[model samples]
Target chain A: MPDAPDAVEQAVRQVLTSINGDLTPTETMLLGELEALAQEIQRAKREISALSIGDISDSHIPVATDELDAVLAHTAEATNEILDCCEKLENTAPELPEGPAAVVNDAVTRIYEACSFQDITGQRIGKVVTALKAIEARLMRVTDRFGSVSSAPAEPQAPDTRTQGQQLANGPQLPGNASSQAEIDSLLASFD
Target chain B: MDKNTNILIVDDYKTMLRIIRNLLKQLDFNNVDEASDGSEALTKLRAGNFGLVISDWNMVPMTGLDLLKEVRADARLKNLPFIMITAESKTENVVAAKQAGVSNYIVKPFNAETLKEKIEKVMVHA
Candidate 1:
């Protein structure tokens, strides 16, 4: 049986034919694609609306970024405490005999060097936070499509004008691939 | 190099600044000042007599590269020795710093020896 939409399409086609002679193949194909897209959109709306989408974004995702922030703060605090200990040890190391003082100072200096791990870790976590926020933004787009966030204005998407990939930092490289201090020193020397 | 050379260490991270300060102290550089970002460091540089700058690469509002360019552009601070001490150890970043007139570059997790060496190297021609 011909469906109700087919009946309406036939009526519209007849009116267009009477006015403009006949519908073009491209226009007919476009109308068909529009109807199919409308049906797919409705199905997607039902499926997305059925799941508790808000909980994933509002409850779980934001907490992950917050937890990352906490880890950065805690590590920074812990590293500072470690450095403070080194500072105190440094101040007292001069009182010891020369040999032991050398050992103590060396150990303290090594500790101070190791404390920079916190800075690297903090930066890595910051990158993670940025990635998580991007995911949250995509989820918000889905939620908005479902009219769950109808009150908030939709984000304006910039038109893609270029075909080239975005120039951005692809980080956390494996060992031996990234630039080492020696390599960096060599590069700097080339400048002179 | 005189132990009294007034040096500036710039970084947004408080812990890093403290670590660098303590490392400098160990290197016999007792005269040191700190700035959390590049802009503040620029202001301090303009107002004071600073011999060297040890700055981190990453910062908001103004980065170490921005500060370096600004310093190089200014007549008074143009000749001031600048060393970049940063976790940004990329080859391109190093090249950029070199081109921007940075005196020496130190990748992070460095020791007092590295700091002392860079300082001595920069100060020799200062």
Candidate 2:
């Protein structure tokens, strides 16, 4: 066991260096190429692993988009339905105590009118959906590039048509940045 | 405000179009037409005799700002009252809309009252 380790290193050195009659120049060169090929293989493996789709963070984009879309769609639909029912109720004009009937009619119409929120919200949600779609397409390209042998479709480049100062069209800022209706009106006043 | 004045509502979303139409109806402005995007709005603006325009800001290919500019650039529609409805409350967006000759701007989630005020103001000024 004392000579075991030393003997193996000595023999390998002899094979590669050809200090002994055990190897030819061609065979030694071939061994060098094989060693290089092994290093190439390791590099290739690292690159493949780097692109593993499983490593991609669970993108909340799709989940958020789906939930937002569903909520917007449902809200819009329900609002429209209520509006229709209100219109019908207004039209029927059933015999009732005139005061209560007028109150109910006005309330119903207000509710019907309030339903317009759904349309604007639905529009905003649509913009979110479009942005999510662009993100999803990129993620799919990333997945396909490393996950599949076939060539993935090329990612479409969006044209740069943003306003000179505004690069991204950010819709409705979060609580902090979003100005209240009062602030907006004040700003308008100041402009005037 | 003339409730009988012909108005054009432009937005990419059908929902927004419907909502604007309904809101206009509530304001007693029933003579309203719809366009789904700035391009369509421009085309309709050319074809029809609309006195006012209410448009959304985030449409594709052409945005409400673009429509505003186009409307301003057009000889026939230059003075037509235009209001922009946007979720973008950024000062820059407001400034840009103002520069583009927008009659007024409405931040999103606005109610019928706000819509009426903006429309009436624009109509009066125009």
TM-score leader: 1
Instruction: Please give, for residues A1-192, the per-residue lDDT of candidate 2 as tens digits.
Output: 423334444556566676556567876676666666656655665675676534333556657877997898788778767767766765555566788778866676567456656755675687778877776667666555645546557669789867532353566676688766677777667777
lDDT tens readout by residue for model 1, A4-28: 4565466666766787786788767
Candidate 2 clash pair list: none
Name every residue pair that clashes in candidate 1. none
DockQ of every model listed? 0.50, 0.47
CA error at residue B37 for candidate 2, angstroms: 0.5
lDDT of 2 by residue, B1-126 (tens): 778999999877675676677667657898999988889999999999999999888777788888888899999999999998877788878878887888888888777778888998998987
Expressed between 0 and 1, the share of native interface contacts present in candidate 2 is: 0.33
Which digits, one per residue and each the tens of the lDDT, describe model 1 over residues B1-126? 989999999988888888888878888888999999889999999999999999987776678888898999999999999998877777877777788889999887677888888889999989
TM-score of model number 1: 0.80
**lDDT of residue A29 for candidate 1:** 82
Give the runs in model 1 whose Cα sits over 4 Å from its true position. Answer: A1-39, A146-177
